[model samples]
Target: MAANTDETTDAELVAEIARQVPDASADEAAAIAVAIGAHLTDRQRAAAAAAAAAGSEETWDGKEWSFSGRIDATQKRHVRVRQESPTDPWSAAGRTDRM
Candidate 1:
């Protein structure tokens, strides 16, 4: 006869992973998520890496800046771009390809 059994779900797996990396920050958690996602498919890994690299921003002269901010429930804007203009003339050409 077949016996009833319990199985671990993807959420359970992720939670187990998170439990293992207790010291991980929010960013680290996201990286771990991508890595786990990558193991499932090669295309997903490449896409995750590309997305990670593309989101990295640096100053005009190649200097990187660290920033942090948040919006409360009163103002729930998904994205905010703070550039000099719609067409940022100061940005180096060819950098657009990175995205």
Candidate 2:
């Protein structure tokens, strides 16, 4: 929880960041939110694209992706991960070590 940015004052921005990346650090979430606020900047676009492409077969609830897959490595950053990267029958778009 470290938001040293002036944008933190905006409750909407903070909430949106939390909604998108709940586990993200305040600073990381803020940076992501700010970039996303700007009509989806390069980083934001890449992240969204990765999310969309990863769980193309899953259902999205506007936030996290829901898919039927075996447990695999979790990730902190949003990036493209190939389906065959893991030998598992299916791999989740993303997972977390914490609940």
Best prediction by lDDT: 2
RMSD of each: 19.9, 19.5
Q: Please provide, for model 1 over 1-99, each residue's C-alpha lDDT reduced to its tens digit, 9 standing for 90 to 100.
A: 112123223565566667889988655665666565556556676899999888774433322211112222223433332343123433422233232
lDDT of 1: 0.46
Q: CA lDDT of 76 in candidate 2?
A: 39
Off by over 4 Å in 1: 1-14, 43-99
User: What's the lDDT for residue 66 in model 1?
Assistant: 13
Per-residue CA lDDT of model 2 for 11-95, tens digit only, reads 6786777887778887777666665555434567789899989877543342232222212224333443344333232333333
> What lDDT score is found at residue 55 in candidate 1?
78
Which candidate number maximizes TM-score? Answer: 2
